[model samples]
Target: MSQPLSVPESHPPPALIVVMGVSGSGKSTVGAGIAKAISRPFIDGDDLHPKSNVEKMSKGHPLTDQDRFPWLAIIRSTAERVCAEQAQSGEVNKGDRPAAVVVCSSLKKIYRDILRGQHPASTKMPPEDDTQERHPSGAHIPATAALKTYFIFLDGTEKVILDRMSARKGHFMKAGMLQSQLATLESPEGEEGVARVDIDATPDEVVAAARKAVKDMIGM
Candidate 1:
């Protein structure tokens, strides 16, 4: 009889990173590149959305709050599982380094709120946005030792992002939808545990800036 191999009891925590922006802002492309550079797994938020949601988006219809509820739930579950897995494991293995990056259009404060709520105790002090009032309760659950939850806001001029979207094809989100996305977008500032980087720069430059910004925000 073959002997059964014993699996390790624990592993390292995964980073619960949300690569967010409106359509045409390069969330998926930049997220994949960042995941590769960091040697972590990347989960495109598009893939997590239900077929109905995709259909709605493809039809140029914007998703309502209802449409996003279940989708965001899945994201939360995945993040929770990754964190639990790491907690069970003593230390993070190179193989286990959190590679889970979710590329989604986390456009509004409400949308970001759902993701941030996963770790209730992790919200830093509220930023000084007189226009914004809803602040999450506490610090979010730590995703990995390297990060609790890292948010990357891909900021770019409307013309630039619109132009890039116009050139891309086959994606469900069309360039025509860019205006709506822009209308819905909420800018990230300090105290949201987010690192904002301009997308007007080259991809390498953007990525470098993103990394530096994230590290600076989290002290990682």
Candidate 2:
């Protein structure tokens, strides 16, 4: 049998870890691996992209900021909702619900800002008490710190990325579009609560690096 992730001496606080990278950087693979390592639920952010966005990407066109705003909003909302649900259910989990992992290509810093609830330009912050806001399950949810986001960037060279992309199939993101994705990516360095790791390693090895980065950030 394969070995389980070794628990650190100190358990970390719950967090929303967004696995960020270009299309071929293995965001989904490493993201799921880290979720398993952390014993948390996994959410593929691509799954939440609007059909319009999907259609655009399928045609190999790069998404403009306008094209991305609505989609980013949805991803932010979904991440927040997951964190809210986990926060409410944490006690019931008896400390078992550590966190949630989001597999996303949060390419730019502005995009990442949107993911973390930084209001877009010309937008006002919502009022503290949003009476209209309630969980879909009809539960009263308090204001959430659930928007807290940390990025785990799966770094890779263009050659490696193109090779990986070339070997994959049945995806809307064509290997031809990799350069556009890489061009759109913003370096996560010096950003609050971000970790970057090279993906030029085995899947488990990549996950281990990601796990340690997450552990360090959350103080595991």
Candidate 3:
């Protein structure tokens, strides 16, 4: 009889997992699921949006790239901050690497690039000593050069998402604005570190798919 093959143990790396898609595609739900699976904190990008942006969206207006840039910056900074906190508190994965999951509308390639720390616009002023940087939680913020960013893009037909949007209540995003989001979306099909998951199935199925994608990405 042939000997059983040994499977190598996988260790999770320091990473920022961004759950991205147009509104009504279930980013928040999927992101939370992924975060729970990975034992990391989950952040909703909508909460980071400026009051003006929320008001605009509440009034059924689509945000421009200019309006989104600042919001994207906030998202990036928040991810970094979370990773830093994790590191300081020894709340990391088995590999001793910090990780965080976030939900963002990151519909454009440029927006994704900013999250990956590849875009100049996402740059911030360098601290004199990154090791000494402090978060509001009193955690030390270290340099995040080793942190990697990944995206799980929830994709589905407009009709499907529109139906979902119609069913949702009290959301600032209107079902009518789906067209604009689709128009702004540049498919991240070939983009590195992106796992596109189709969201046309039931909520449980979609979350399972997203969790699989995240596990595949992190080798968990």
Most lDDT-accurate candidate: 3
lDDT of 1 by residue, 176-209 (tens): 5777778878776664678887898777888777
Candidate 3 worst ten-residue window by lDDT: 1-10
lDDT of each: 0.61, 0.68, 0.72
Which ten contiguous residues of candidate 2 have the minimum total lDDT?
1-10
lDDT of 3 by residue, 42-145 (tens): 98877766555667899999877777765666566667776665765566644555777899888888888877765455444333232123223312222234
Candidate number that wins on lDDT, 1 or 2 = 2
Per-model TM-score versus the true fold: 0.68, 0.74, 0.77
Clashing pairs in 2: none
Tell me the deviation in Å of residue 219 in model 1.
Answer: 5.3
Q: Tell how far residue 47 is off in model 1, in angstroms.
A: 1.1
Clashes of each: 17, 0, 0
lDDT tens digits, residue span 137-178, model 2: 212222234446789989999887776666678655655578
- Candidate 2's C-alpha runs over 4 A off are 1-14, 51-62, 90-98, 122-146, 167-176
Instruction: List candidate 1 segments past 4 Å from native.
Output: 1-14, 51-62, 86-91, 94-99, 118-147, 167-176
Off by over 4 Å in 3: 1-13, 50-62, 121-144, 169-175
